[model samples]
Structure formats: structure tokens, C-alpha cells
Target: MSKQRSDEPEIEPFTGPAGGWGSVRSLAEVLPRERVAPDALRQLARQNKPDGFMCVSCAWPKPADHHPAEFCEEGAKATAWELTTLRTTPEFFREHTLTELRGWKDYDLEQHGRLTHPLRYDAESDRYVACSWEEAFDAIGASLRPLDPKSVVFYSSGRASLEASYLYALMARMYGNQNLPDSSNMCHESTSVGLKAAIGVPVGTTQLRDFEECDCILFFGQNVGSNAPRMLHDLRSARKRGVEILTFNPLKERGLERFTDPQNPIEMATGGETQISTQYHQVKAGGDIAAMMGIAKFLIEWDDAALSVGDPPVLDHAFIAQHTKDFESFADAVREANWADIERESGLARTALEETARVYARSEAVLGIYGMGLTQHVKGVENVRMLVNLLLMRGNIGKPGAGPTPVRGHSNVQGQRTVGITEKTELAPVEKLKELYGFDPPTEKGLDTIEACRGVIDGSVRAFVGLGGNFLRAAPDTDAMEAAWPRLDLSVQIATKLNRNHLFPGKVTYLLPCLGRIEEDVQASGPQAVSVEDSTSCIHGSRGKAKPASPHLLSEPRIVAEIAKRIAPANPRVDWDGWIADYAGIRDAIEATYPEMFRDFNARLFTPGGFWKGNKAAERIWQTPSGRAEFLAPGELNATGFADADGRFRLMTLRSNDQFNTTIYGYHDRFRGVKGTRDVLFINQADMAKAGVEEGQIVALESDAGDGTTRRREGLIVTPYDIPRGCLGAYYPEANVLLPVEHHAEQSHVPAAKSVPVRIRP
Candidate 1:
């Protein structure tokens, strides 16, 4: 057989509403080829149901009322991909060497199929061999027992269910390790830190129901159509209800511009679509903070002018006075922000900012929704805080239809954090763990994702255990990470499919196959259901009905329990077997851990649509040091101008419509009008002219990290796109090699993947 080759990417302009017959056709093509069973439609129907499996693509909240089909095209692709009949057994691994596998693209590696059995690396043979669960567990235990607990870093993916995350956290703490680095560190850590500082909470305050009541909604740096397709339904409905939707993004996302719900048969058949965004502002890359501050300044000026005439004040004076603090300082900062600086930084006119402010001020209830665009920046925390400052000016929080909402990427990422997966070991969860499991949790701050990578590079982290993620490919500075990964004494990955991470073996590597979310998980007691928290903080049960991909597969909860049993056999406090046998017991423990928040956890699962976890910000109850919502002011507006002296473009890494996180479903990005390949860069037409480059010119991209360390990706076809001048867009993982590991958000420590300074080489 010959080596696989990607076809040349074909680029064209797409002009249609997102999610219509096109999505339906795409789903049809993938489903049949994946050998989806006849009952696959039934299984899809049950998705997002109270007692059914949750879509593994995104964390958008499920509606209170269930539709016949609650899943999106991306969700369908994820499900079909998971349920594919292909299997990667021992023979498959024997046929392909690690070196050969390394040559394949990320999509091909996972597309090869589901892992069937446990495998261990045979360094002498340079291949993986079949290993029993007992042997793998024993080897892991022996390797971990000798190493200092601090030398091991336990990392988790957001895809892990609440039960698995809870058990993984417990197992790590019981083993006396606090280095818990999760996927959230790379994505939403900025939102957590920013929101915690401003409103005393890390989660979004807006509920799904709030969309119904919102008069105006602002989408900052988020592409709702591609990232979270289901969100378009809410936007379409809101638009129909005369709700004004304002969009601020560098690219003109079709989902935010116009959307045709695939679920609406009449609209799909008639080729009718609803316009989503009333006003679309093309902000520059890393300019969200400036745009937000500009809006705040306009609102403050309007309020002052209104108050000077003794007329009705534009600002919510009563709400601000009663429910907030530090208003004077925050207002001063907004007032002092210069318009010229804001315009230069945001790449938007002053009149546009004033118009947005006018719409916001006139609306009784407004909602601000953002994604990684706002969070994956050098000053990501400040960007989020500035957004909150804008909303606070009108008292948006703790009210119906108004608040700040950070849309999470992964399906259960928010749930994983809610279930105690954090580097910081808080007193309440630590005390609860001691009471329930009799283990003293670590008190010291642990390593985050970046710190974990640094630890691996410095040889401080010897053993690595991953619970469901492709850490090697997902992390930044691919060259550095690849170099650091082999230094570990042992590395283990608990995953459902074969990813690039598995090919990068340590001294002793183990690949443990776990059941996918679409498969039945039969525990010692019986079939079990795991719960996940949505972006809106709704806790619901997800029970898979599909058959297991392989009989050798073990549930994630069971794997964690067995691993803990081997590593901490002498710890008599916790009954690992008991917890794995039944997941309800785990929920009971979660209730004990967060008594006030998760009271009656098991019973609440039976509710028609899941129970809300309840946010204090939603209730107008502040939990900050001042016992009120605090207005955190941002610093001076210092935007990384569109281009540098050397004509370097500000490159923002993005995901294609056919991809989720590190998982690539196909080579086509229907919405973006790219097909057949991923090796392409979306550049503005003017930038092409300025750089003396033509359309479809293959160019090399070199990072301007300023560390004298050269990092570059060669032979990338330049496609002129509808983007801001001097700004370029490229797919992640493929472009991750250009990002420096040390370049990250100031306070959140998240790698600034969204805003990397790079220069093109012809």
C-alpha cells in the first residue's frame, strides 16, 4: 500500500444559510459509510434527552422541551465517528509501526478506528503489543510507586463525564498528587479567572431560557454556527421575536449572519433562512478588550450626558448602587479610554461603537456571549473583565435575559470543573473528600497545562496519565512537547480511539481502551448512566444504548477505580469497587462535596429537563470579598496592531466545521468553502497584495516569538478570505507548531493560540 496523500484544498466563496439541506446531506454521507446501524436514527433521537446520551461535540445547553432531533450536524458526525464499526485491534497495531503511524495526519490516525484492547509499547521491537488489564495496571502501579507523587501529572480532557472526572480527581489526590491539568486550562481558564474576579463566579450567569426574554444579545469573538450549531436555533428564535443580535468577530461567520435550522423542514425545503446578527462589527484579532472598553466608554458618556440635563439616566443607577462595588474606579477607567486608541485597536469606527452602545442602553435586558476568541489572548482575563464591565454598566447580571455567557467548547468541560477537577484544591471539596474517602487532599497549588508541559520539559514530571484527550497534538509548541514527552518514565492514556498522542511513547507507555459515550457501560452492578453539566449549568443524565465497540473495552469510571485500587491498595477509607458498581453513589458523594449547590442530586436527575446548578450571580447574590459584584477595570488599550514592522500578520488558529477540538471528522469545511485538505491559510486580499503574494500561493509561516527559536510551517496555500487586513486564519494543530509554548495569557496562563504574530515567507 502507498502512503496516504491529501488532495489539494479547493477554496470558494460560500453564500448560504448555515445548517440546511447541506448539513443533512453531509450527515447522510458519513452515517452510511460508518456503518451506522438501522437503529442509529433512534439513538440520535435519544440524544440530549433526560435519560439519553449527550452529544459529545459541544456543551450548549439542552432546551427544556425535547425536539425529535436535538443534535447538530457536528454532534451527528461525532456520534457516527464514535459508533463506526472499524476497530484497531492488536493485529492492526502490529501491522503499523509507531514511525509509520507518526507520518499520518491527525484525522487519519483517529479515523483508523476504535481501540479494541489494551496495548503496551515494546521498545525493543519498536511496536505496541497486546497486554492484559491486570498487567497494564500492575506495570503502572510499579512505575508510579517508586516515583515521587509530585513527579506525576494527571491530565484530563473535557469529554470525560462527571463520574469519570470525579473519580480521576479522587484517584490523583489519593495518590498524593495535585498536578491536575485539564483541557480547560488551554481554553476557558481565562473566563474562569476573569469572571471570578469580577462577579465572584467562574461560570456563565445566563441560562438558556434567558434567550427568550433578551431584547438584545452581543456575540463577541464567537462563531456560533460552526462551534455550537444548536445555538443558532436560539438565535433564530430570538431574531424572530425581534431580538437584536450584535456580532463582533474578525471573520463574517455564516451562522451569526444567517441560519436555516436543519430541524425546520419547511425552511429547509423552501431555502428560507433567518438573519441572525442585526449588526456585524469586524473587530481586529486580539481587539475584543478595546471594543468592549469602547462600548463601555460610550455607555458612560451617554449616561453622563443624560444625567446632566436632569433627564432619565441611561445607566442602571439603582441596580449598580445596590448590587455592585468599585463602580467609580471602573467608570473612570472607561471614561479615560481614548477613542483614537480604541478605534486603532479594535479596527472599528467610533460611530459603530456608539451605535452598539445605544442599542445596549435602550434594551431592557441584554446578553453578552463570547467564546475562545475573547479568552485565548495575551490579555484574555482583561478582555473578559471589560465585557463584564460593559454589562455591569446596565446591571445585566442577576436578571432574566441579561448576563455574560461564556460558551464552552467541550460537551462536559464545565461539568468536569464543577466536579472538582482543578489545580487549586479548595477547602470545601478537600474537606468533603476527607469526610467521604478519608484522604487528605493536597493543599499546595498544582501545575496547569502549560506548567505541566514545562515540568515534562524540565524532567520534573516523570509519569503522565491522560484521561481522554490528545495532549501531544492539542498542546502548543509541538516541537517542544514532542521532545519533552519521551523524557517521562511512564505515560498512560485512557481513550476510546487511537490518536497521535499514543504514537509518542515514553519509556514505558500503555494505551488503555475505554468505552465511548455512545456505547453501553456495563459495570459490576449493571448498566450505568453518567451525568454531565451543560454550559448553562444544567445537570442531566446521559445513558448510552448502543452496543460496546469491543468486549475488551472498559468504562472510564471502572478504569479509574481499578487504577486507584492498584496504586492505593492500603488506603482503607474509600471503596473504589462500590463507586464503580453504581454511578448514583458517585452522585451522592458529589452532593456531599457541594452540599448547597448539589442538594438532592440523584433525585434531580429525574426532572423533565435536568436541574439547574444555580449560580449566585443569576440570583443577584454576590460571593466576592466585598459581598457584591465588583467592577474590575482593565489596563490601557494596547492592541497588537494589525501588522508589525516586518509585515507579520496576526494569525488566529481556528477549527473547521468538520472538526472538534483535536478531532478531525473530514477534510471539508463546508461553511468556510474549503475542501480536500487542511494545509491552507485564510488571508485577506489586501494582505496578499501587500506581501506580494497571489491567491493559492504556497507560503511558509514563521512565528515571531522573539526568542530566537525558529518555528515554521511550510507549503501552506494562501487563500484570500473575508478577514481583517493583516490578519490570517489557519486551522489548529496543523498551525499549532507556529505557536510558542511560553507565549500565554498574562494571568490565566492559557497559550495565546488565537493571537500569534507570524510572518509569511513566499
Candidate 2:
């Protein structure tokens, strides 16, 4: 932390995007801010039993022990957030109305605290009043009954149990609407769609143990330290073992730099940090396909030269011949690829690109890990396939410590999507669910987060219900989402605490408080257990230690079950109560629904560290249409730049150190030296000169998203940094304003946060 400078900003010249550079520097003006602490901080601090409960914050792999340095800053924030002594009770809401609450800032709304009890907004009273759990459930049932099934949307957050998620999907499907939208629809749906299309499975290629035996790791667009910091440990371990972890990103992040693991007694005592990324290439955002193709080209050409001599070949020719198809065409495509195009589009010198290729060729085993940075682009799916193509070129898919690794966010997000929580159009899942639950699930495609927002505004949607996540705030085009949510007949959120989304109440809003993941769930049978799947695709048990924050707070499973039990076929055949009381019955149903994955769910859940599904360790038996890994090469490539007739820059939205997804924990990003605010930009120095802008200057952002929405942020900090030229970046969902819902990847409905053609104006 440092003091703020009132004047005389010494930002290096912006060489990246026009005008946006000046906005990057104003970040210096707001220096060193901290979260104002609540009266009491409820902390587990990674020291309290490692086997207790997984941190709801980030997906950092745990080794089932009480290692002192298990948790990172973000993990701590998540723990504090969940266990915070703060409460958002009915009395507090009684003083506030949806109209008055609409004026509150995102931070203030979350800062007021957790939801203590079930609350129903009273229109006549102009405030929220406390209601009993039964009454709340009844109100939900009443609202659910006669609306066209298509008019209702059932949504879930990633931080939910497997039992809860299954029940939620079952409940919605039983009520005749399979319009299930979830947090994954916003983040990793691209990974699921693209990877499943390419590889048979829809998750990452490498599991936890792969790090120890790997020689190379390809990192694309993932800020490991800030987002999933525990992964830093594996990288650090691999680095010590002489593995080359290549980082390809537009910006140089601090976490990617040498990390001093606080738990390493020697490092902490000696003030030492382990070097994580052996080679860091500043590739332009959305330019990964070109760079990846360059690797395949180098492998083919290098192997040819090697075989021509008396030397061994660079490629595993035997492996390629055994598994892949179209090698000759692939070779010709790479051979004819324009090096100039690759260099310029990638924003990397030819020498640097060749060096990365040389390293990748030398390593026999490699794991390419990516995050939203790759998926939030127009070429997101292509980028995924390109990475797989590079692996297939030399047969890097099935061997030890080699393959694609899509590092996912939201602890159980992968599982949520796996259990039919998708808003996809196919009604087969609905039909299957109907056959199981004795009711026909709606066949029409449901609204995703964006579509739901639009539906509310268009009057197509009568009510919007979110089982857990923050709907209004998580959406792009904040004004539209904020406005549209209130237009609904009934808007409801099942939350643990007060958040900005709760303030955006519709004509009728219900804020039903639920139990946190860390709280013990006592059921009719007795104390129960829940399950969550980590990013590695390993499902494990989670048993909470503390009692519920309040006795009135019900588990999310119970809440969803109650909602289901209330509004189902009048005299439904299935016993929803019997399943809710005993979570295993829910697990048994999950077993029947997904026997290949969840066989004997309860029995295996009690096993040490739980179970690993058919995952990374399962080898390369892809569940794709062809029952094998896939290779795809797009006919053309798109470059990074927001240029008009004249060259400008495209601003890419990013996450700051302070926030997690849409949750505003605080207004400080410790790694980037950003503090006291979430509104700032990062730009290259030379571009500032070209645009005639100075540091600490306020500027308006203009874009061509074609949604007729104007996204302008004044007083933006223009800091000089290592982002690629002709491009700019800022924090999201704040920067999501620049992204129109209409601007998404061609294949996956994911918004292109990686590339938004925009220019900053003075």
C-alpha cells in the first residue's frame, strides 16, 4: 500500500491503445485502499482442518491437509465473505424500499451485510418485511402457478451442492420449464461447448497429479495468482522440477512473476520466490490461434529437417500416425501460413514465437491451461481447437502430464452444467426429466442471463428467479439489466447476504436467505453432507463445522426442495419431501440420472478425498461425436485492434484483484497497485502519445458494439503497462458496459470480453 499523489503523474508513455492509456494512469491517483472490516471477522484461515470445507472463493487444489499457506488473498476474501458476522435482516430491509434501494451503490449494498431471514417486499409499505420460511415458500408457489412455463426462468449459482443442483433442475423440470440458466452460462459455457465439440469431454484435460510429471505447461489468458492462486503452487513445483510453463497473455501480471510461497519456510525466511513462467509471451488477445498454429508448423518443419539428417525427429511421428487424421493437409496449411501475419497478429516478434515453438518441441509432455481470457473472444472456440491441434500434432493428448487444461472458475460450475443446468434449446433433457418426474418439461429454448434480461424488458418474461447468483449486477449493460429486472411481475433471489442484485427488486421481489456452504446442514435423518466438483473434475464431500448463521436459515437444497414441493403436479407421484429430508435420495436420483459419473454417490463421497469422475486421469478416450479428440482450423484469422479508417484500439475487459466474478468484495486490486476504486484502465505507453493524451486524464470510451448502448466511463486511469499494442483492458463487470449482449462468440453465446473495438476520447 502507498500514498496517493495529487499531481504530477509519472506514467510511462502508452504504447498500447489510443486515449485509453491516460485512463490507465489515473489509477495512481487513488492509491492504497482497504476493505473497511465488519465488527467481527469469521475466518478459518487455511489452518482449520483442510478436510473441513472447501473455500468458496477460488478453485485452488487442496492436498487434504492443514498446510498453513493453503489459502490466497482471494480465498481469504471468500471465506470472510461467507462467514462474515454481518446480517441483512428484515428490519434493515423494512427501512428501505426498492425505489430507495435502487440508488445505493454496489459496494454499500453488499457492505450492509448478510440476509438474516426470508424477506418479501411489501409494495404498499414500500419496504421488505420478514416472512416465515413456509410463507416465503408459499408465496413462491403462488407466483409460480399460472405463468406460461416459458415466462419463468430457473437459475443457479456455482457455489451450490450437487444435491441442491440436481434437485433444482428436477424442480424446474417438474414445473414444466427447463429454462434453467446458471452462473456457468456466463463464464465457462464456452469451454464446455468448444471442448466438448473438440475433445469428447467438456472439462480440462489434466488432473491434479499431472503437474508433478509434466515437462511443459502452456498457460493462456489465465491470471493464476489472482483468480486461482493455489494453482501457483503446482506451477511453482513444476518450475522447481525444470518444467517450462509458457504464459501467453496481452498483459504481464504480478502473480505470473516469481511467487514467494508464504508456507515455504525457507522462502519466507530467505525472502525468496519461485519463478513460475519460464517464458512469457505477450500475445495480443484473440491471437492465440496464430501462435498455436506456429507451434504445429515448427514441429512439422523441424521434424522434417531432423529426419533428413542422421538425427532423430522432433515429432512423435508414430503417435501422430496412430491417432490423428489429415496430417498432410495440416502440414501444408502450416507450411503456407504467412509468418508476417502470425507475427503481426500475435504482437510478438518472429524470434520470440520461434523460441516458444522450440521449447514446446523439446518437451515430450505438456498441459495447456486457459481461462476466460481465451473463452471470452470471437475466436474463443477456434482458439480451444487450435490448442488441441498443437497437442495432436505430436500426440500430446493421452500421455502422462499432457493435454488441454481449461482452468474453470466458480467451484462447482463444471458440475452445475454437467447436471443439465443448461439453458440450451434441446428439449431432450426436459423430456427425460419429464419421464422421470411425471410432467413434461418445456421444450422451447430458455433465456440465458442476457436473454432473460432482454425478455424482462420485452415483456416476454413475467418473472425472473435466481436460485443463488447475483442476476442484475452480473449482467452486462448494467442500466438495461437494472431497469429490466424491475419490470418483472415477480423477481426473486436466494441469497446468503445483501448484494446489489437484491436492491433491483421487480414489482414483487423476494429475498430468501439461505445457508452458506460452510454451515452444517441438519436434515430430518440427521446431520447431512454435500458434494462439489473441483476444477480438476474431482467430486468430493463437504461437511460444515459451524451451525447455520441463524436457525431460520435453511440449506439451499431444502429451499429448492421446498419450492419444488410447493409448486408441482397437484398430487405429484414422486415424494419430494422424502428426498429433501434425506439428501442421499437426491444423490440416488442423481445416480440414476448419471450412472456413469455419480455411481454410489453417498458411499464414494465418504471415501477419503471423495472420488474422481472419468476425468484427466481417464486418458484420451474422448466422448465426442467421433469418440476421439478433434482438430479444427478456421479459414481466416482476426487481429487485435479497434481501428476505424484510422487505427484506434479495441478495449478488452478484465478482472481486478478486488473482485470475484460480479461480487465487489472491496475496491482494491493489490497486485496491480490499484486501490480505492474499480474504475481504471491499463494501456501501453506509446499509444498515449499517438492519441495526444496524458496520464491521469479522464476520457469517454466509444465503441461499435451495435447494440445502441453508449458505454462511457469518465476519470479513468491511463497507466502504462505491457498489454499488446492496439488494445486496451479494464475491470469487469464494470467494463462489461463496453460489451453488448449481441456481441458474442459465433458458436458459444459467451460475450466477447477479450475484444471490444473501442477508442478512448478526451
Candidate 3:
């Protein structure tokens, strides 16, 4: 059925529990909102040796002395959801046919319970019958025996262990395919692409320690509390010490305005929320690049003019001369930029924009932090370049408490890219993988998410395997993922729980149940531990406390190793079982593979917080092709707000308060007053007025235009918001219905979620 108008899917709102970041029963609804007794949840937590699992939710840096309760609310939710006593055994599948399961919601799919055994969907039987691990692997291996390597696409999630990722990459390379469409392509592809072109590396330039000493912190589109609450403490401490903190975002998230640190006993007792945002600017959705370029624009011209007037100003002329190239063109772009246009288009007044520039100019050190909002646009790469340009103008990189901070969302997402997850560039380490394995890796550039989707539909891709993540739900345009999967010869999902992605089976579907990060991994050796790198490049150890939820549940590493062993090309010397038996062997292999990047891997992992990778920006050393960071000239600006047309307001899909990626928490977003359904769209009052739509009016939104097909979901209740004028916002996956697969960024293939051109149908 080409899904037509929806009279607003009912949204169920949920308020988080009183227990601060760790209290997650309320958020555990990401799986099933059905409330288990407090006693049952308490029991679940008691055994959850959560030490081994990286917080599945956010990338909070690991502590020197790990707390038994180091888990955050989202972490707890994911942990409980994974380690839940529930199970989706063979009988459960037998009772509820695939057809019955297909009718379920995303929450119900995961809530169907964890898979206890390796399952092969039996279409004739209309059930997922349990199969022997050997039988499952053999069947999978035989399926890949004849296809050209390019037909196999190895997709992975950020939550994957370093060992699993390395092995997965090795398998793909050995198989001679580079069709690696990872989570990075979907999220931080812009950051990686932009940062590499502008600076040297694709990772964040600053460390967490820099926050304490930063003179001024500028947050662009990042809501710290909801996304990264640990940053809340840092900003709070900085504010107390008289550091100026400026925030610019489309949504004036209440969490950004004031955050109560439930982590602090005294603050929790007093019920006091820290007041952040010394200055808040509600900039337009696509304004970040303009805003940043405006800042750089103002500082460059102001300082240049000031120097001519015999007055010293803020631009670091000496640093620019020594560490950068192409000054004249950059200066021209900044000087020639029209402030009226920037102010008008960005939805910020000139004075406010100029004042923000002044803050950057005046500060001895500044950190320009951004989230998905900046990098998920058509000009996302340029947007990042402008931020780096501002930093370079003042020599922010390589200085303490300064540089660009791309506030990533997940715990291991950064680690995924660092370990060479991209389909672009043949990274040195990945190259070494080819050299070590004695194979000629595919020289042709690999397909990213969008390319992979298109590849599958066109029959170029024969097999698709996801290490983790909801590929169907996580991807844009539900129809694209659904249509593509059925075309594949085989589709494998190595996941902890059942999701909709698994239901959309290929010709020969295999669902391999894996252990959650929070569960104990008892192999031939003993309990195992994994490591993850946060956005700041700090590597830390994660150990699981909870015992296996099901006796048959396989650890991620074990499952990956088994699959690699079976499905990998013949004549492989590496003993997959040797590594699976003990993660230390995997660590040793990683050390052998990436000695420069991962020195003393095994020894240092025993250290309290693992180790920190040296960030060049911290030392002001740009590793760009020029040996110094190159400041990119600003790109041309795109039109904004649809010429004040009476069309549909622009819709930006957002994650629900309780959701992570495609996993909907309780169908509600509290900060924005959305509850009981995700069918609500946040509309600017002015945009609503122009569109002739009221606050509660329901309307149709078509997510795509270019493609022959369109995703139309109607009956969306419009909620007026304090967002940028002419902008609309709604929850994703549910709203993924409205995001066209083709509406992606230029350099990154990332969906231009923040700025898709759409007209509201009255």
C-alpha cells in the first residue's frame, strides 16, 4: 500500500523519572512502555554489571573511577531494554506469525522480546524457526559463495565493538568489496568530509578538559542537556567562573536554558537547575554557516579596518600567516558578505550577530560546538568550514579550551569513524588491512547509504548485512529501505533485539541474536570488556555486569567472529575463534593492525579511563595537506523560507525526548509539548499564519518531490513553536515519512533534514 494521509498518529508523552540521568524506567519505553513493577526494574539493575557496556545512549566521557551507577537515563533504558528478562523464543514466533509481527509498531517489534536463538525466516511456514548456529552460518556462507565481492555490503552501527568493526572491515576487504555504508555516512559524514578539507582530521578538535578553561563557549544547534548532559556540568561550572556562554539554535530547548544536575546531590536536594546561555539567539535552521561566516566576516573586516586605523584588533594575523594559506580570497569573502542579507536570511539581527562575533573576537579561547543541526544541511560541509575559519582567524585550534567541537550523539559513533568506517578515502589503517591480509582491496570508491539504497534497488547489490542498528527505520524514506531490502539475495541483522528492519526479509533472511554491551561475556577465558571512544577522542573501557538474558544469546564479538569465520573468503589465517575466545587476542590484533593509532592497546586499557588520542588542535598543529590548517572561503548562500510563500512550512525531523535513532521512547517530546503521538509538527506561528494553518490544525506533508514517488503523511497536528520563522519540526522515523531519500546534503549524502523544501498542504 502506498501509504496516504494519516490523521495524525497518536503520540504518547512520557515524563522521565525523578532519579536523574540514571533513572530510566520511564525512558525504557523505547522498547515497551508497559510498566514493570519498580521491584522488577530494581532487580534488573542489581545484576546489570553495567560496567562493561558503553552507555548506549550518549557519549558521556568515562570517569577515572567508574561509578557502579555510571549509567545515564538513556543508558539505563537501553541496558534494561537489552537485559530485560523478556525473550522472543521459537514458540513466541510460532504463535505470532510474520504477518502478525508485520502489523506491529516499531516499539512492538523490539518489544516482541529479544531473540534467544539464531533464526531463519521460513516463508512457507510463516514463522522464524530456530536453527543451529552451524546451519545458519553455513547457509549464509553458501549464499555469498558465488556473488562478486562488490555485491556484498557490510553495514555497521557505532555500538559495534572495535574488534567486530575491524573484523567486518577485514572480511569486506578480503571479499574484495568496499560497499561499506556505515552509520557515519548517515550522521557525521559532513563533519568528517568538511573537517578533513578545512582542518586535517575529521574528529573533534577539542577535549573535554578544554571546557573548564574556555573563556567563551558558542553552542550552535546543540542542546546540551538532552543530547549531552555531562556538558551541562562543564557549562555550568564555566558560567559560575564568569565565562561567557552563547547559544544559537532554531529551538530554544528548555534544557539549554536551565538544567538541573540530578547528578549533584546538593542541587537535586535544592531542586536547582543551572542557568546556561549567557546570551541566546534563535537563529534560523540554515543560519549556522551564514552566522559563522558572518562572524568570520565581521572579525576579518573589522580587524583589517582597525589595523589600518592604527588600532590593534582580535584577528590572529601572525598565526594565520604561519599556519594557513590563501588569505586574500578568504578575506574578500568575509569583507564582501552582505550583512543585511545574512541578517535577513539567517533570521538574526545585525547587532546580535555582530555581538556574537565580538564575543569570539574578545575571548582568549573559544569553543564552537555544533550538533546534527549544522552538518545535516545542503551546505553542511561549508557550514563546518566557516566554524573552523572563525577558529583559525583567532588561532582557536591548538590552544587550551578552544577549537571546533562536533557534539556527537552516540557513545561509539566517534570510534566508528576513527576505526575507519567511511566509504570514502582509503585510510592508511584500512590500507594496511589489505597489505596484512595479502589481498587487493577494491580501489573504487564504495557506496554510502544513499548509494547503497540505490544499488540494492537496481540489483547491483546482492547481499546486505547490518552489524547493528535499524537500517530500515534509521534510513530516510521508509519506502526506499523497504523496497531495497526485498531485492537483496540475503539480509543479515546482527542485533540485540527484534526491529522492523528484520521483518522486511530478503530472499534468505538471517536474524542472529547478539549480547548487549551491558551483559556479561563469559567465553573460554572469562568475562570480557570492550572499549569505545567518545566525541573528544578519549578511549575508555566498558564491561558488562548483567548475566546473559538468554543462555543462547551470543556476545557481539562472538557472533561477528563466527559469521566472519564462516562467510569470509577461504585461506584466511586469522583464527576468528582465537579472538572470540578472549577479547585480548582481538586487542592484540588491533594493536598489530593500528600500532600508531592504538599503541599499547592491551596494557593501557587496564588504565582507569583508557587513553586519549592526541588532538592536533589541542597543540595548534594542523595536519592538513598544507601542513597547516587551511581556512576555506565561504560558499554561495541558498535561498531561505520559500519567498514567504503560502506553501507548507519547512519541516525538520527531530528525535523524540525518549527516542534514540529510530527507537521511539514513549512517543512524546516533553520540552516541545508534544505528547501521546509523533504526528505533531512544530510550526513557527508566522509560518502557520502565512500558510493559513492554526496551531492544532492537521495537514498533509509530502516528504519527497524529485523521485517519481512521494511519502505523504497527513493529519499532522501543527504546534506553534519558538523556532525560526517558516520552519516546522516533527519526530523522525515517524517523520521519516516526510524526508525524501533524495533530500540529502551535497558532500555527505546525509539527508538535509534541517532544510528540506516542502509545501504544507492545507
Which candidate has the top score in lDDT? 1
The count of backbone overlaps in candidate 3 is 18
User: Between 1 and 3, whose TM-score is larger?
Assistant: 1
- Cα lDDT of candidate 2 equals 0.72
lDDT of each: 0.87, 0.72, 0.73
Among residues 3 or more apart in sequence or in different chains, the pairs in candidate 1 whose N, CA or C atoms overlap within 3 Å are none
Which of 1 and 2 is the better model by TM-score? Answer: 1
Count of clashing pairs, candidate 2: 28
Deviation of model 3 at 364, angstroms: 0.8
Query: Compared with the true structure, what per-residue lDDT tens digits does model 1 show for residues 118-214?
Result: 9999988788999999999999988898888888899999999888998898888888877888888999999899898889889899888999999
- Per-candidate clash tally: 0, 28, 18
Models sorted by TM-score, best on top: 1, 3, 2
Ranking by lDDT: 1, 3, 2
What's the alpha carbon RMSD for model 3? 3.5
TM-score of each: 0.98, 0.91, 0.93
Query: In candidate 3, how many Å is residue 106 off?
Result: 1.3
Over 195-263, each residue of candidate 3 has an lDDT whose tens digit, in order, gives 887777888878777878799988887766556655666677888888888888888876668766566
